[model samples]
Each structure stands twice: as structure tokens, then as C-alpha cells.
Target: MNTIKTDVAIIGAGSAGLSAYRAAKAAGAAAILIEGGAHGTTCARVGCMPSKLLIAAAEAAHHAMHTDAFGVHIEGTVRIDGREVMARVKSERDRFVGFVVAGVDAMPGADKLSGYARFIDDNLLQVGEHTRVHAKSVVIATGSSPVMPAMYRALGNRAVVNDDVFSWDDLPKRVAVIGAGVIGLELGQALARLGVRVSVLGARGRVGPLTDPEVRNYAERVFSEAFRFEPRAQVQAAVRDVDEVRLRYVSGADELVEDTFDYVLVAAGRKPNVAGLALHNTSLELDANGLPVYDASTLQAGAHPVFIAGDANGVLPLLHEAADEGRGAGTNAARYPNVEPVERRAPISIAFTDPGIAMVGARHVDLTAESFVTGEVSFEDQGRSRVMLRNRGLMHVYVDRASRRFVGAEWIGPEAEHIAHLLAWALQMKLTIDEMLRMPFYHPVVEEGLRTALREAEVKLR
Candidate 1:
């Protein structure tokens, strides 16, 4: 039996776990990373990277077909080779995983162990056969897995989730995507652009219910033009036989309808991955959803010197948030003797769609400002959006008239993702609307939309 000791033992090598490991090492603590599967986890292998690659490929195909609108005539028919796209996506994913693995391997005083890890005691972990690691503190960053609805169990390997979307060799002739969240809308649009007759069914009022209502309306409009969107629809069951999958749902008037498609991709949502950790052995307690209960401040599970980060804590499953939480947990775990819990700022959520959606701070309804003011600027008014032929989007800003501080911002347009960081910074720094507008912004760029939005907000305040 091989026995090892470290100051910190981090489980799962995903974004959160890797961040924790690096943070602990930088804090001069000995850290060992234990991963059940390969490094990089779902984000690098299947979730974010591969899915975005497919979306980019679809965008390219869409642009090629629509180039005629820009006075460019195509000599022949436009085609998409799914096999080639999958090959490239997989190659890039593998390259990214390799780079992450190499970086983890080179870290000082850090050992990467590959195997299923389980808790043997409070601060002890057993990784595979005969290897035991005892650490003063431990961090769990197991991440998450897509929830497979029971009704679609029969679809099995045919019904893919976010993880296996890249493995699809050929685009389906007709596909049904269950769920209208971020993954569903993004993948649904990607498949639709690849010539698949895509139908999206959701139980919510809009595609992205988690986003602001304005953002959801814009996303619904953009994606509905490409795919069949059945909002406020409840899915009852799915049956797969031979070549096609059948989906049954209830429509507006309680009318049951059935839709048959070549394939169905389930993207309902994700649950925390904390099942096999044997958390009961320690003082760590799980909530009703079987997720670890941690202090929102220190992220500590209990008095067992164990902490939870990333999706395991269920505090927003975004990669950036997970990374930040991991850093906090790692630093706290390594310096538990004297470190104080750091305050976390609110997170910004951004979804990548045709128009792209970015949200920061509180929504309009969440805050109570004496003079609530809002402003919007259309992408059609921007010279850059017009020149790029991507003119269907809007930018909105919210301000507190009394304090004059910028409270929130929402945008659905070109370069909206890049502009969101500025809004997040302004909200974090407590910058006023007047202060933000005084900053000089370059003309003819997408950022001009922000300046315009602030200017319009000033008028609304009056």
C-alpha cells in the first residue's frame, strides 16, 4: 500500500479543483490533486469547448449561405460535413485537455492521481487500490453532470446530453431538444443551423428563464427564427424505437401532441456530482439536493477541515465562479490557522447565442431605487453591427437615480460579451451613471452602444 501526506488534498481536476490546487501551491501549501477521470473534466472535454466549436461551425455555414445578401454570389450549393466538424472539435478538445494536464503535472509539490477517490475518514482519502492520502484539509470540486429525465431512459446512447454532443458523427435530419436553458438553446440553434429541423420544448415561459426577461425575449426571437420553440410546454414522455424518437407533450389548451424526430438531446439541467464521495464519514452534511452544505463565507463543509467548491456547493455552476470559489476554499484550507473568509462579489452570467446575452448585478425588479431608470440602444444604430451585417440586438442599462450609481446592465448584441465586463466592474466599484458616461469611448465600435445606453438613461432619470 502506498501512503502519502499533503497539506491539502483536492478532488476532481476540473476548473474548480485545478484552481484550488494552484492556489494552495501558491500559498506555500503541499497539494495533491485526485481525479476520477482525465484532467479538464466536462468543460474542456464535452461541455463548453466542443459545444462552442460546433456552434462556431454552424455560424460559419450560416454566414456562407447568407453571403449573397452582402453582394457575394456563391457558385454552388453550401454544404456542412458533420464528420469533418466533429473531427476538428475532438482534436481541439484533446489538445486543450493535454495542455491542462501538462500544466498540472509541472506544478511544484503537487501530485496528480487518477482513480476514483472516496473518503476513508475525516481527513483521509483512498484513491483506487492501495493508495491512501492523508491531508490536513481537503477540497471537493467534483463539478456536475447533466440530469437525464426518466422518461427518456429508453433513448439511452441515442439521446445525447451536453457531454456527448461532440461525438455526433452526422447531423440528424430532425431533432428534438428537451429544455430551453443555456445548453438547450445553444445546442438547439447549432443543430438547426446545420440543416437539422430542430424543435425545442420547455416548461418555462421563455427559452432562458434564468436570464433577465428582456434577454429571454431577444433570445426567443433570435432562436425561434431558426428552430421550432415550444415555450410553456410540458414533456410527458419520450419513446425511441428503431430509427426515430417520439416525444409527447401538452400544449396550450391541455391538448396532448406527439412529435417524432430522428434524435432527441436532453438538456434539462445539471445536478451536483457528490454521490460517491462518502461524505457521511466526515462531519460534512448534505442538503436536500444531496449537495454539501457549506458556509457561504468560508465555503467550509463543517468542522472536518473539508470544503466544497464549484457545482458541488450549488452556488452558480459557472466556470469563472467555480474558479473563484476554489481559490477562496484553497487559500482558506491551507491557511485555516489565521485566514479570514473573503467576501465574494456577485457574479455576471453571459450566454453565447447569435445575438449573445450578458447580465450583471441585479435586474430591474430586484432593486428598489427612488428613481428607477432604464435605457436601451439598438444594434442597428451601431456602425460596426451594420457593417458586420449583424444588426438585430439591443443594449439596456439600469441606474439608481438617487445615488446615480449604475446598478445593472443587459445586452444582446455583437461584442456584448466583451462589454459586459465593464458593466460588472462599474457595479463592483460602485460607479455612478455620470462617472461612467464621462469616460471617452471610441466611436463606430460596439462599445458606443454602452455610451448611448448611459446617455439615454440620463434622459429617463429626468
Candidate 2:
């Protein structure tokens, strides 16, 4: 068996692992990165980049078809060549992936191990069949895998997951998204806009990660226009009949709904990739969720030298959160001799669907009206939205009533992402509601919507 030694051992070469590798090196630690999968991160390969490429194409097609409001006249109808669309998506995806892979290839550090890594102990790992890695510290940025229910697996090629959805040469004429979360909504909407009939099935009626009941209801209504949504849909069984996939589900009111889709895309959820690492070899104990105990802020696992980061922790699956966690883990791992925990970033997440759902900082589910005051704005009356023919949305701001601090916000409307970032920064900096409102408010813009919401909250706080 071959033996390799390093100051820091990074398991998985995805975004979290790569970020840890850089942070470790920056912290003056010699590091080795190991991977059993492709070098490109999930975002670049299948999650963000490829998904956005498809969304862009669908948006273009949608706009061309709905140009009537702008007094634009077209003699012919807009159409998408499915095969060509996917080819371009893959082409762009490969380019983004190539950039990341090239960087890994040129990086000079402890030798990159090219195989599955399993823990032999807290500070030791065995790579594949022949290589053993010894390190002063280890970072588990192993990432996660899309959860396709076992029932759906029976459909074989007729069913798709995020990984398979991006690689398809042509899309099916009809698609049923198994979950209404970020991945399902984004891809489902894109497919629908591109002329494919799409439906979403989920046990909850909520859209995006909205925790506020008002925001969730508003988002559901806004998005319902794009695709068929089975709110409170409990899927009991699935089977493949020849070339079509059949789904048997119970709707919100106990009505049985059965449908056959040309392709079933299961965006159910994702499970952290931990089993292969052999966590039992160490002293770590997994929680009920099957995730090892770890401190989120410090990225430390109990008092051990091992650390966890990225989707592997199963906290939040957003790309930015994964990157931040990686740096935190790297810092702790490199400074293990005198290890100190790093401060965690404020929560921020965005759903890249139309109307653009975004949630930031504290959630409404975690607050009460008695302790916090809420401010809201309706885009139905906003100037920019009317001009853009997107005059539909809702925004909410949550502030500590007594302290007047901008704590958190959730919104479902046009440019929700922009508003989210604005408030997220304000909240992160401990800015007061008055401070947020005093920031310039520009007219005839989507951002003005944010100003209105802040003002509404500010008045109530006083």
C-alpha cells in the first residue's frame, strides 16, 4: 500500500473541498485533495450553471411568444429545437466545468488522490485499494446526492434526476417534477416555458423556502400560472408502463390523482454523502438524520480534529453557504494546534425561478408578531413592475420591534434576490430599520419595492 502524508486532507473535490484546499494553503498548511468523482463542482456541472443556461433559453422563448404587450409584432411563432437547446446547455456547462478542472490540474500541492476515501480513524484515511493518507487534520466536504425515491427508480431511464436532466439530448414532451423545492421548481418552470407540459407534485403547497405563511401562499399563487402544481400531494406509488411513467398520488383533500408522464424528474431532496467515508471508524456519532455531530459555526466535529462542511453537513444546500463553511473548516483545520472557531455568515438563499424567490436571515417561522413586527409591499401597484409587465409580487420585512434591528426577510416577487441581498447585508451588519429605510430609494425600479416594504416596517416598529 502507498502512503501519503499532508498537513490537511480534503475529502471530495467539489466546491467545498476545493475551497478548503485553497484556504488551507492560504493558511500556510500543506494540503492534499482527494476525489472519487468529477472535479467540477455540482453548481458548475449540473446545479447552477447548466440549470441557468436552460432557464435563459426558456426565458428567451417565453419573451418572444409574449411580446404583444410591448406593441411588438412578429409574423412567426417562437419555437425551441429541443436537441439544439440541450446541446448548447451542455456545451456551456462543459466550458464552465473545464475552467474548474483545469485549475485543479495545475494546482501544485500534496498529491491529489484519485479514488474513494474511507476513514481509518480520526486523522487517517484509506484511498481506494492501495493508498493510505495520513494528515494532521481532515475536512469532510463530501457533498450530497439527489434523492430519487426507490419507487421512482423502477422507471429506469424514463425518470430523471438533476444529473441526468442536464445531460439529456432532448427533453420529453411532458414532465412531472416530484418535488416543489428549488431544483424542481426551476427546472419544471423552465421546461414549461419551453413548451413542455410540466407538473409539480409535493406534500406541501409552499413554493421556495418561504417560512412565512403569507409569503408562501402568495408565491404559490404566482407560480401556479406557470406549471400544474399538486399542492399537499402525497405520492404513494410509481411504476413504469412501457415508455411512460405512472404516478399515483393523493391530493390535498384526499382525492386520488393518477397521471402518466413522459418523463418523471425526481427533485425530492438530497442526502449527505457520508456512508462511504466510514464515519463509524472514528468516534463521531451521527444524529437521527444520519449526520455526524458538528458545530456549524466552527465546522468542528465534537472535540475531534475532524471537521465537516458543505452539503455533507446537511444544514443548507446553497452554493454560497457551502463555500463559506469550507473556509471556516479550513481555518480551523490549519489552526488545529490552537484551534479557534470562526464566526458564521448570516443565512441567505435564492431560488432562481421566475418571480425569483429569496429568503434571508431569520425566518418568520422562528419569530412571533409580539416580539417582531412585519412590513410588506405589493408589487401589484409598483411602477417598475407595471412597465415590465411583471406587475405581480409580494415582499415582507421582519424586524425586532423593540430593538428595531433588521433581523430577516422573505419575499416572492420580481427581483426578490436583490431585495434579499440588500436586507441580508443590512441585517448582517446589525443595521436598524431606520438605517435601511434611509438608504436611497430610486424611482421606476424594482428596488423601490424594497424601500416601500422597509418604510412600512419602520413605521410599525416605532
Candidate 3:
């Protein structure tokens, strides 16, 4: 066995692991990264990038089909070549992965190991083929994988999960999406737009259940035109036959219905990849969800030298949050000798759909804040939205009436992703509604919605 020593050893070369590696190297600490696959994590390869590409293509096809609605007549019928679209998605994903790999290689005092990494002890990890790495601090950023319910194990080949959804050679004529979360909604809408009949079933009363009620209502209204959405439905099992994959679900009435589809997509969420890490050798504790329990500030797993980041720790498992957690963990690990830890900041969550969804800080109902006021502005009133012909969504603002500060903001509309960053910065800086509203906002732009929302909030305060 070859033994290697480093100041920090990061397992998983995904977004979180890569971020940690860069932070450690910049802090003058020797670090190494290990990944099980040659390609990067789900976000880069399967989950986010490729899925979004397909979604974009589907949107284009939708526009082409509906050009007549905007007074633009198209002579030919719009058609989507699923195989070609998938090929483009794969190419873009591969390019992004290559860029990530090259960037990792360029980092100083950082090495990459291509194999599965397992914990030998608290401070030691063993990769494939007797490659032992020792470190004073270890960060588990192994991320998460799509959960395949045991009920669908028998329908393995016929069912697809998030990680493999982008690799389909041909789009199914009918797809039964077994979740109503972000992934399921995004995929369901994209496939539906691609001319596939999509049915989304979930236990929640609406799609994107984690989002605010207002956002969920809008999404349900918009997507229901093309998708068969069955909320408050629990899937019991999936059976595969020669012709189709049949899903049996119990509806709110406790009646079972068997829906037949050409394919079944299991997007019910994900589980942490901690099974092979041998965490039992150390004092690290697992939460009820089978994820590593760690201190929010330090990302340290109890008293153990092992640290956790990304989906492994299960703290706001978005890619951006994972990167932030990874950087904090690496910085803290470098200063482990001094026991100085980084303070964790709240994260902003964004969902990318046709009309994006963005949220930052606590909602009015979620906070114990007193003297707070809330305001909302519809995108239908925004001139920019009218010009873009995408006038569908709303912006909501939560203000602390006592301090007049902008405490939180949520939006569902065009450019919501870009506008959410501004909200996050304003919240972090504790900017008051008065201060935000006074700023000059460009007219006929989505950002104008912010000013309009804040102005309405000021009126409510008066």
C-alpha cells in the first residue's frame, strides 16, 4: 500500500469537494480529492446541466410550435428529435466536466484520485488498489444519489432515475414522473413539452411543495395545461411489462389506480452517499435521514476529526450551498489546530423552470420577527415582462416594520434567478426597505419589479 500525507483529504470531486480543494490550496494547506467516477457529480453530468439543456430545447420547440400565437406564422410543423437533443446535452455536459477537471489539475498542492474512497479510520482514507491517504482533517463531500424505492427494484431497466434521465436514446411517448419536487416538475414539464404525455404523482397537495403556496399555485396552473398532475397521491409500486411500466398509486380517497406509461421516472428525492464511508469507525453521528450530523458553523462531525459537507451533511443540499459549505469546511480544517471555525450563513434556494423560482431569507410566516409587513407585485404589471411576452409570475417582499429592513424576498418569474442574488445581498447587508426602494432601478427590466414590490411594502407600513 502506498501512503500519502496531506493537511486535508476531501472525498468526492463534485461541486463541494472541488470548492473545498481550492479553498484549502489557497490557504496554504496540502489537499487531495477522490472521486469514484471519471465524470463529475450529478449536477454537472446528469442532474442540473444536462437536464436544463433538455429543458431549454423543449422550450424552443414549444415556442416554434406556438409562434402563430405571437403573429409569427411558421410553415412547417415543429418536431423534436430526442436523440439529437440528447446528444447536444451530452456534449455540453462533457465540455463542462472537462473544464472542471482542468481547473482541479491546475490548483496547487491538490491531487485527484480516480476511484471510490473509504474511511480506514478517523483520519485515514483508502482509495482503490491499496492507495492509503492520511490527513489531519478529512472532509466527506461525497454528495447524494437518487433514491430508488424498493418497490421499483423489479422494474430496474424500465425505470429511470435523475442520474440517468439525460441518457435516454429516445423519449418515451408517455412518462409517469413519481415526484412533484423540483426535479420531477422540471423533467415532467420538459418531457411534456417534447410531446410526451407526462403524469406527475406526489404526496403533496401541489408541485414544488417546499416552495411557497403562491409559487406552487402558479406552477400548477401553468403546467397543468400539458401535464397530468396528481397531487396527494402515494405510489405503492411500479410493475414492468413488455409494453409499458405500470404504476399503482393510492389516491386521497384510498382507492388504488394503476397508470400505464412507456417509462417511469423516480425523482422522489435523494439519499446521502455515506454507506461505504465506514463512519462507524469514528464518532460521527448519523441523523434520522441517514445523513451525517455536523455542527452548522464548523461542519465538524461531533468530536471526530471527520468533517462533512454537501449533501452528505444534508444542510441545504443545493449545489451553491454545498460549495459554500465545502469552502468553509476546508478553511476550518486548515485552522483545526487553532480550533477556529467559520460561521455558516443562510442559503438562497432557486428552482429553474420556464418561469424561475427564487427565495432568500426567512418567509414572513417562518420568522418570529415582530412588526413585519409583507408585499407582493405581479409580473403582469411589469413593462419588461409585457415586452418579453413572458408576463407570468410574482415577486414578494418581507419587511421588518420595526427596522424597516428588507428581511426576505421571493420571486417566480423571468430573471428570478438573477434578481434573487440582489435580494440575498440586500438581506445580508440588512438593507431597509426605504434604502432599497430609493435606489435607481432601470425601467422596463425585471429588476423594476423589486422596486415596485418594495414600494407596495412601504405603503402597507404606512
Query: Which candidate has the highest TM-score of all?
Result: 2
* Total backbone clashes of candidate 3, pairs 3 or more residues apart or in separate chains: 0
Q: Taking the tens digit of each residue's C-alpha lDDT, what string does model 3 give over 126-186?
A: 8887689999998889888888888766786778897677777778789888888888888
With a 3 Å backbone cut-off (N, CA, C), the pairs that clash in candidate 1 are: none
Output the worst ten-in-a-row residue range by lDDT, candidate 3: 338-347
lDDT of 3 at 180: 83
- Relative to the true structure, candidate 2 reaches a TM of 0.97
Which is superior by TM-score, 1 or 2? 2
Q: Which ten residues in a row have the lowest lDDT in candidate 2?
A: 337-346
Candidate 1 per-residue lDDT over residues 237-266, each given as its tens digit: 788878888889996457798989887888
Model 3 pairs in collision: none
> Native-vs-model 3 lDDT?
0.80
Q: What would the TM-scores of all predictions be?
A: 0.93, 0.97, 0.93
| Candidate lDDT (C-alpha), each | 0.81, 0.87, 0.80
Q: How accurate is candidate 1 locally (lDDT)?
A: 0.81
Give the Cα-based TM-score of candidate 3 against the true structure: 0.93
Error of 1 at 174 (Å): 2.1
